[model samples]
Target: MSDIVLLNKHQKKALVIELYNQGKTRRQIAETVHMSFKDMADIINEYTGEDKQVNKPEKSKDSRAFELFLQGKQSVEVAIELDMPADKVEELHVQYWRLSKLDNLEILYHEAEYSLSLLLRLHNILKDKRITKDKDISDLIELANWFTRS
Candidate 1:
């Protein structure tokens, strides 16, 4: 019998990648990580290939939204510029830009940006570790909470 360890998202991904490289079965890795078989299969499917359709979102939409946000445009301005509704822009802002429960809205954006960079670093590292799937979502949330704490 193996011990069940509560891993953060980064750690889970790292473990998966390492196990994959060692030629472990997805089922075995799932068992080791205390995940469901279905989740293990999904993770293997997502991270194991270069031409993975599940991995890529539309580039232009992501890039344009990011670019507009970076240019210091207000969500309303962004909406007009991008020909999207203001409400939709607001949705994007809330989704992509973190909204703080305390302090000014602008500060929240800056904080979110910094935190996002940290998450991105972890994400890339995990990618190198070859983690796939949204299976380890709990761990990911845990990691994100850790990011906020730090």
Candidate 2:
């Protein structure tokens, strides 16, 4: 695991400007810098002198809702845990789902890679043991061969 770097307020502002100049969307910049969406909007508003009123709950609250949701807790349970309204918990869960879509894709990619590696290892073991007579092992070997093919 990589070390987590904490950014000061000034550093965050500078990074926000740099990312914005690099054509990153506000949401992207916020996620990249571990900032809240509301804070990112405020920074953009400050830089561009646009007074856009974004009404979002605190980042901690939103994160708590998301954490519970990811843990398989229902919205009502999360609300009870966080002492908030169930509707609000549901709304935060939806936002968390949207925000984590890219992360989920990366997870799926890694899972597929792991599964392929396991299949290849199993195929090699079965072939070495001369167990290809089994229909399931033969099918698995074929599938592994298909995967290894360009």
Candidate 3:
């Protein structure tokens, strides 16, 4: 492959990030972008985070979530249609975005859905005469505080 002579450092950095996100190996990126291994390593370290370097292995496109995503369905729809747990749907959502490079993160939908579900559950438990014990109340408190900012 020919060396990229006209590319600036900024352009090289962007290329590195794009290649990294596409699951290219360090050597492949360096060679493609015409950088020495040291230059490539420094760019990867300085311009990117550990999370950027991580890529889930590609799965077949036959997944229901994949089909839904291709059809432009949002997270809440995908979750409901598949009847999956929030965490699994979120995981698939993350993977889908990484591969597709689309800015389609539906965080608010998860938060609203989860919050409403939790609230309804809490309301049911509060009205239950069986939850008269302090332990159950403590568990409820813990559940209410499940997702606080660290």
Index of the highest-lDDT prediction: 2
What is the total number of backbone clashes in candidate 1? 1
Count: clashes, candidate 2: 0
Model 1 agreement with the true structure over 2-77: per-residue lDDT tens digits: 7656898778877887898899987789878877776666666668764556667766654687678877778777
The estimated TM-scores of all candidates read 0.29, 0.33, 0.29
lDDT of 2: 0.79
The Cα RMSD in angstroms, rounded to one decimal, for candidate 1 relative to the true structure is: 24.1
Measured over all alpha carbons after superposition, the RMSD of each candidate to the real structure, in angstroms, is: 24.1, 19.6, 17.0
Model 3 pairs in collision? none
lDDT of 3 at 39: 78
True-structure lDDT of candidate 1: 0.72
Q: For model 2, how does the per-residue alpha-carbon lDDT over 18-135 read when each residue is reduced to its tens digit?
A: 9998999877898899889888878878998885644464568777788887888987888888999876875676676668785664454457755867767866998898877779
Q: Which pairs in model 2 have colliding backbones?
A: none
Alpha carbon lDDT at 79, candidate 1:
77
Q: Candidates' lDDT values, in order?
A: 0.72, 0.79, 0.76
lDDT by residue for model 3 over 34-67, one digit each (tens)?
Answer: 8888778777777655443456665443387978
Question: How high a TM-score does candidate 3 get?
Answer: 0.29
